[model samples]
Target: MKMKLELFLVVMAVVCAAGKPTSKAAAGRNKLLLISFDGFRWDYDQDVDTPNLDQMVKDGVKAKYITPPMLTMTSPSHFTTITGRWVEDHEVVHNMMFDDKTNLKLPHKLTLKKSAWWNKRVLPLWITAQNQGLKTASFHFPGGGANYSGQVVDRVLFEEFDHPDDNETEWRQNIDKVLSWFSEEDFHFVALYYGEPDNVGHAKGPDHPDRKKIIAQIDRTMGYLREAITRFNLNDSLNVILTSDHGMTTVKKRPQVDEVIINKYMDLLKLTSFEILDYGGFGILTPKTGKEQEVFDALSKVPNVTVYKKNEFPESFHLAKSERLPPIVVVADLGFNLNSRFIVYVNKGDHGYHNGEMDMKTIFRAFGPDFKKNFLSEPFDSIHIYPLMCKLLQIEPAPHNGSLSVTENMLLGPEGPAGTEKPGSGGSQGASLSVALLLCMLLFMSDVL
Candidate 1:
């Protein structure tokens, strides 16, 4: 009897010792759901009451501002958030990029079947996680469908089948599908994208009544998502991060501006040697061979616009580091857009301005097992978010520019420096103590017997 009891206690000790490490590893494997509301400005929640978002802020961490990468456009910004690299580093410098190497133009409208436009330089979080044996799903997210480094996400809903619109029911259906994915045992990470407030913000200005209505609708959808997470009891196990690619700003057509200023100079500057890509608020001028000075001299003289030689562009913006960038870049002042005859009507709102502009800032909110509650973080560069995602998922991050230390303070418990104990590991010491006590009790009982 004594021998049996001793053997049992020894086995129990081994089991407890083995189970503790598993628990620690499992604790780090929380589900992460990243949701992007494209063009959702940082202040939209402030302009309209967003109870669901407000509740999330009250329950999770909120950043004061998320400064998007330079160009402040959707594709580049989204890729930046995922890859933690600047436009120059990632090579997806604009929403519509032309690859000179393959002579293939990649527009936002291009199908996922085409992969040449995606940057082969960097690995996105989904690929990183997937490579580490985690299942990842992307729903209509930029770069989600494209295979990076020869590895595509485990599941993807390319833009052709899944496009974002103003329909709340359709949005809910997407959410339902995401929830169902979360229910799957193998689904570990997911990214969801919604084009909202952005679509309406373009048709109607950010402050327009219609825009406000859509913002409210977005808030309601968020509320539904929160309710569903609670209903499924996944609130503590799942992390939901909401952010936007860039914010929108009101824009007005500069009547005949392109014709009077840009067009007139184009003929005089012998612009045939240059490729001028105009994006309403900004333009990129790629001068062929020796025409750089000529293109810069003409556009630089134009009023209400700032022009920079590619090398002279602000280093802080991180825009000029890539050879793919044009020789000259021009940006119009806020509230003004470059005029083009092809445009039927000036968009009421636009982005793609200098990222430092406050109007270009976007939202950042996170709720999950890993984030701190009721904490408001100071403004930080969006590049840092990739490292935060890596930390939360406990995945080894690929080599990138972002530093986890920048955003580590926003997590709960000792996972952050300020916290008293490390997250998930807090229970391990207690578990050890319990096992020791049990061993002691067993030893005492055996001696008595």
Candidate 2:
């Protein structure tokens, strides 16, 4: 009887050992499709007319909200999303940038590879994914035009579309282009960025009728992507993730800009350009020269705007600590926005508001074979996305300042029966730690016995 019991115990141990998930399948090749819709708010996921995105939520996982960078501009927010680093670290803080050394202030262009202001040390996810020998592609990534050898970037389409200047219309073509590319290439990872909703939202405000129209347009585009993937028989092989850089809020009121107050300190400050631009609620005063302190003090005395130095910006904004950030960052009081000559001419609406307000919370969702069904709900940081994509494509995580990979696993659920290890919940490598402790305890017990 004792011999029989021993043999049964050994068989059970063997079965248990075989059932444990190993690192092999986790490190295996898998395809990833990362898409971002600019200015896509959290409210769009409601039971309204979103048939395409609603299906994705039912088929996969969705987050309550995703946080954006401090400045909340396209350059910075999108940069943070792709590289998992804040604007200060990546150094693309605003759409209009100033190079202090050259005394050159230039409107931000999506320059490929060579910009004095952008920090290239913080690599993008495509770089890491490509380094692992997986194919990669990007469509209209905010700064995706830059050709940094640091990340493994394969095919990048960075130019802006000319006709139909509406982003929603152009986005449909971009999505079709990406689907065609996916069909032709054996790409292991791909990213597509849509700038139209953000464009319309900024131009028409979040509550404008055009904002809802843009949402519908995006839904149709998403449907095309989902349908194309299915038709190509690549659905099972693809991990589709969708998110946005930031959200949009309505401009309830516009603040008057007193040219007299601006001029009082304008010449005292080394004058760059004196135009005031709406930076969401606050305005950005870029000195043609780098007199940040003078500009900041001048702006601080204005009605309800609080001035924040580049360094003084909250750490939660995750702006890289840098001297190059705009000299005077202004925050408008609630219910107020800055009325710039530029804004009056173009956008009827805009973002770039207080860094900490919940109004800026954006949307994030994932639908694919690897993602769990209807699992995630709580809000998460945008930084977590890089690591999750890396895991899906079997690439090394980008070296970043503490991303939230473990917290994001709520999207994946208890790791599948396949060899993919469950990403830990609290950011601790708990499964590995638990295994080590168990092994040590077993060895100690064996020696004593």
Candidate 3:
């Protein structure tokens, strides 16, 4: 009987441990560093040499591709990654938002102070981790400064757009700051952002030689970061995830948005107002009351443009359900930009077009103790990253739109049983506890027998 009781206690402990979430820290991996390279295309590494990133893949895991949400703009894509929600759900529908209620226009102007432009509908990972008593930090990451659920990260840095220039000195500083937070302040989670390839990709086309040069420079920065991690003896303790918000596409031509064509059809329409919300790729045309059909019919005839009513937009895009979206959304074909007045020349590249095109797919790679070495995962949506982060940090995620199943295969374990809960379901603490109890009972009964 004494032996049986001892065995029962040991089994109970094992069952209890199995049910609890294991944080990187608890598992002897102390830090998680999320790094973003804006507009890094899925295939950019193949076009140029990225020895540092290549080494990471050799040592860790890589996803084939990460599909961005609809619109595919920088701000929306980054927000989707952090919150694991769609643009409409997060209320940051565009980089520049016009609030009809307050009659205020919020553009993507760089500001250090927090603004009400950010919606609190969903909680980002920083806030979620901080709420669970883990120290968090963010450097120039979108949604970093925003107070979600009345909580901000313990350390925050808002770097300006031009900070990455000057041989990437500011980029190195950002990296140093994040390392300090982990080593000194003991922050468990840190988000770092760099505006690169995207900047050059916009100024010079994605296929341009300058873009390749920029990618190489970014790779060198990655090498620097890897050296720093090793210097601090953090290579084993740190898990670094590198990704991009969206990819770039070359613009071969611009479709003229002829006012004359619209004016010709205006005689038959009762259009109260017409405004273009987004201009380049995913052009949004907000029309006045009851004139959606008239505007759609007119814009449908435009060259290189496809018009869809809000209700008629593609269901796979998950874009039509947002109140913040315009009634008519126009998307230009690949290698084309929408322009008004005359044929505007586009000598460079642009994004924010259709998300279905492969050119819009971005990079996803991770390295550290938790990931599988040299493992290449199938392509997954970027929205699924939030739940993965929550799992890695051992924090209860707020209600989000991501699913653990989407990224479960990327980890170094069994895929396990499928979760019946909906995507972005809140933390499964109750479920975990219930499973723990059942296992405990089963072990106890076996020992008694």
Candidate 4:
């Protein structure tokens, strides 16, 4: 009898061990598609009809809005999404890479391929996923093409020079290509990029009719992407995330408002050794060694522009600690543009302002079998997206600033036998407990036998 009980207990232990979800396949790792439609504002759909975007909200999960990191440019903000670190930490400080010693700023396209600018001892999502036995493809996602610590993305596509941003045909072609990558090539993840509404926004302002037209195009693109997913038979196995880097606001142009021209306040060649001005809303100046305070003082009095010493920059911005940042940083007030010397034309729409502005908030939408249906979450920071993607991939992530706790609530529980409740609702654990209790009852009954 004793020997028989020992065997039964061994069997019970084995059963319990089998019940635990230890293997990767137990939870079913789903592939991910992270798509960024550059400069799609949080409320871009509010003024326009975006049926596809509206359908996304109904079919999946949506956030109130997602906030981008400081120095909110294309490269820095996108880097934050992948690295889960602030721009001050990741150090992709701007769209244009600045060399303080040479006082030269590379244009946006050149900066995309410059390895030194992007691989700042950080592993972006592509390299991180690759390190853990997954394949990744990047379709012109900013920072996706750069080498990271001697490692490169598995597959990459760079946009041809002056590629038309509004080519709907090519956009669908890229979508088909991405679907092929997942369905035929067995790619696990992809980060696709689109330049739209941003280009229109830059030229026509956020509220212009042209902006609305581009937005309609983006809506159609969303519909096409979703339809393509179904046609490729990846609807059940893939998670799709639609998001943007930053929002666009109307630039307060001259004649309507005074422009913030720095040279008008202080002589550029005399007081500053280097200046990164004539951009939209942000400025960085490397004062001639000892002219930091003078430059700060002179620029402080300039109307519509706020200047700061590197150390004195607002801690809330999360970008002041970067080595790449110059000593003097200036930001124009909302809707204003900063000029280096003379009054010059600026984009009708611009970003890179303090993120607290409502216009600076962007959009986030996540859809997949793993996510809850028709869920609307409160606003979250974009940095948290990295950890969320890592979780969806079921891979261990390297040390990152984002917390999985912030995003896990949006996901449903792991799949088990049918009728299992979600993870947080205690269904799996409850089932395990019930099984243990039944085993105990059986043992007590066996004592009589």
Candidate 5:
């Protein structure tokens, strides 16, 4: 009984040890706030009067634009930034969770709970920081709500599919809440998300008047956020990064051009056993047994659509290597999307286009005590962010695909770690993941027995 008591105390000690600021960079490191506004194009503020974003550019760093992974949809692209892996490696391949065998599908919001799809080996920055003894929170960031290994983000605010994105009042409330987390609760990292502009972009198009209204609202919220940061007295210690998943494109409508609809060319139901189509610029088809060639040939012939067998997918996409993918992949041209299986209402605007397209590029702006002032960077890939975050927090990264050297010049300090430093073993431990896991297992067994 005494031995058990000692073990229990040890376990409690480890639990309590977490969330304390012990960044390898230093004790009491500057807090990081990563904010993502979905579908915010690089040039959205070019014509609009966005004083807050403009102030961010003058106060901190702004990128010409950052590239997202190919097949650039919401969930996959966001996951790419968070995990620092390509689409195939992270395996959060699409906005929808799908089972090729059962032909089952779950939309983006529902898929957040499906950890098997999101956290298959590589963990996000929040988990990595928590393991290194820094507390982290996420508000509506994609994949933030799911469990990774044996842990979840220290704090999370999840949403449903129908949640409105443009609530200015609620947006300020979230800013206040996060400010409290940093000020009163002492969180080292917090990721906030807004579904704006993306929702308005889809329903009313990226260039529509409604999008301008939402942009104005976003700017106003930014003003409130900056003010709240001052009110919380976090101005000296807080570092803020504002970016987006992917940019939006105006979808080609009817009458003016021949809208590329998949069903118009091939009998989709007759071609494949399962499919994930009508979502955006990409689609995956699981061909019926012995009918693989037939499906590939048919989709390939569709004008403005590009088709590939899973193995034949472009290597540059970083998506061809995953076994979780369907046998057949279909890609539509810019300004086009695959639909017709269940076309209810076509979005006036959409993303999931090739990352090379100018319209597909998203914005990047960051400000903090650690970052350089008023520096404008050339374009960089979103993958670089993971390693950059790891560097800022002074935590070892989890063997990611991003390069630290790409963004090193923007920091205030002299370049420290080369991009090739070794990584953590990816368990929830500050020093040694294996030892931590073993201790955790022992605690679990003791409690159960």
Candidate 6:
């Protein structure tokens, strides 16, 4: 009994010692805030009157350009952001994905799984932080806040998909919900995903005047968010990183690649069926049987069309990295577009091809404790965000592919082991917010588990 008491005392002492801070002065030591401004452009705020985003750039490090994926679509880009694993490795190759393994589909819906088996990227930063006992939160990212690793995430804002189309009440509700998350407690790490910019940009095209208004509105909302965090005195410990899924390009003219062309080519050669999938200047062509070369040659004859096979694409593009892709790809030059038989009747801005054209430029701005105060001139991958956060939060990286730690250059403080500090001021604030969100997650996890 005496020996057991001595052992208990020793354990308590160790816990107390571990809980004590190495320096009381390092109060702003443990928080990270990541924000994603959907469809943010390289020069989005150049002419706009976006005060909050402009201030973030002035106060933090802004990337000159976050080069988008060759595919330059939404889900792939977003997957790159959170996982820090490129589509080449993370396996969310495109916006419309068909997982070859397991035959499971990830349609535009939130998924909840028993374990970390669902996501292509093994462990995201938030999950890693949660595993290390660091408090983490997410607000309406593309993939629903399903905790993959069974631990670590403290809160996830539920996305309401009941209304497919945009509603004013629902949009405002999402913003309020996100703001409430930050107001709760000292939050070590928080990620907010705002969908208006991307949603509207796609709906109205990037050139729409409404797009600018939407961008400004979201910026204002971010300002409100910043004010809330400051009002709660959580800014010093917070790092606000703002980025986008992909950039946008205006569609010029839509031209059909023609059934006549396919029929003529087939008559001259041997083939079965030819199908075309259309989106703006991008089109995916599938040839029946193995006559891809004949189909490519026929499509190349079309005015303002350049065709390439999957394997012929550049290695840097990363489009050919996955096998779940069409055989023939079409890229229409500037002021030109391609369409299927159905899309010839419908025309809209789209992004899903590798074009040498520079219109599809994405943007990134990071303001907070972990970044430098000037432009980050270095060309960094969007995937770098994954490991960068890992280093910032000091979490051991979960099993993943190609996410290298960017801590030494990114963080301002000592790069010690993760989650070593006692329950932080942010954790208390986060815990308060976590109470309500935890209940929601429990219900959510129960339904999905």
Which of the numbered candidates is closest to the native, going by highest lDDT? 4
Model 1 bad stretches (over 4 Å)? 1-20, 26-28, 99-106, 111-113, 161-164, 254-261, 274-276, 340-345, 414-449
* Least well predicted 10-residue stretch by lDDT in candidate 1: 268-277
The lDDT ranking, best first, is 4, 5, 1, 3, 2, 6
> Which is superior by lDDT, 1 or 2?
1
TM-score for candidate 3, residues paired by index: 0.81
Model-by-model lDDT, in order? 0.78, 0.66, 0.75, 0.86, 0.83, 0.59
Across residues 2-116, which tens digit of lDDT does each residue of candidate 6 receive?
Answer: 7545655655555455445444225545567777776676776666798887777677777777666655666667766777665666555545434333344444443432123
- Candidate 6 CA-lDDT value: 0.59
lDDT of 4 by residue, 1-449 (tens): 78757867875775676466555445446799999999999999988899999999988899999999887788999999988888889999989988989977889988888889998858898998999889999999999989887799999988766788899899999999999999998899999999887899999999999999888988998899999999999987899998999999999865777777788889999998888888888889998978888988899899987888888778888877788898888988888888888877558999988888888899999998778778899999899999999988878887788898988888886542255653334455556757766776787788877
Per-residue CA lDDT of model 2 for 276-313, tens digit only, reads 45455645556655566666666677665576765676
Instruction: RMSD for all candidates, in order, please.
Output: 3.6, 7.5, 7.6, 3.4, 12.6, 12.7
- Candidate 4 weakest ten by summed lDDT: 416-425
Model 6 TM-score? 0.72
Off by over 4 Å in 6: 1-29, 98-118, 145-154, 162-176, 179-187, 254-276, 334-336, 344-348, 374-379, 399-449
lDDT of 1 by residue, 73-123 (tens): 888899899888888888787677565434455556573345666745888
Tell me each candidate's TM-score.
0.89, 0.77, 0.81, 0.90, 0.85, 0.72
Candidate 2 vs candidate 4, TM-score winner: 4
Stretches > 4 Å off in candidate 4? 1-18, 26-28, 415-449
RMSD of 5: 12.6
lDDT of 3 by residue, 1-449 (tens): 78767766776676666566655345444478999988899999898988988998898889999999997887889989989898778866667756544445555645224455565477778877877878888887877877765677788877664564426776776677788777777788998887788878877889889888988888888888888887767775677889989999987642443321233434323562444433457766666777767777887777666878888877788887788776777788876676543444444788878888998999999977566678899999999998888877767888888899988676654221243332123236446666767766876788678
| Lowest lDDT 10-residue stretch of candidate 6 | 257-266
Q: List the residue pairs that clash in candidate 2.
A: 88-320, 113-146, 113-147, 127-151, 127-152, 272-288
Between prediction 1 and prediction 6, which has the larger lDDT?
1
> Quick one: best TM-score, which candidate?
4
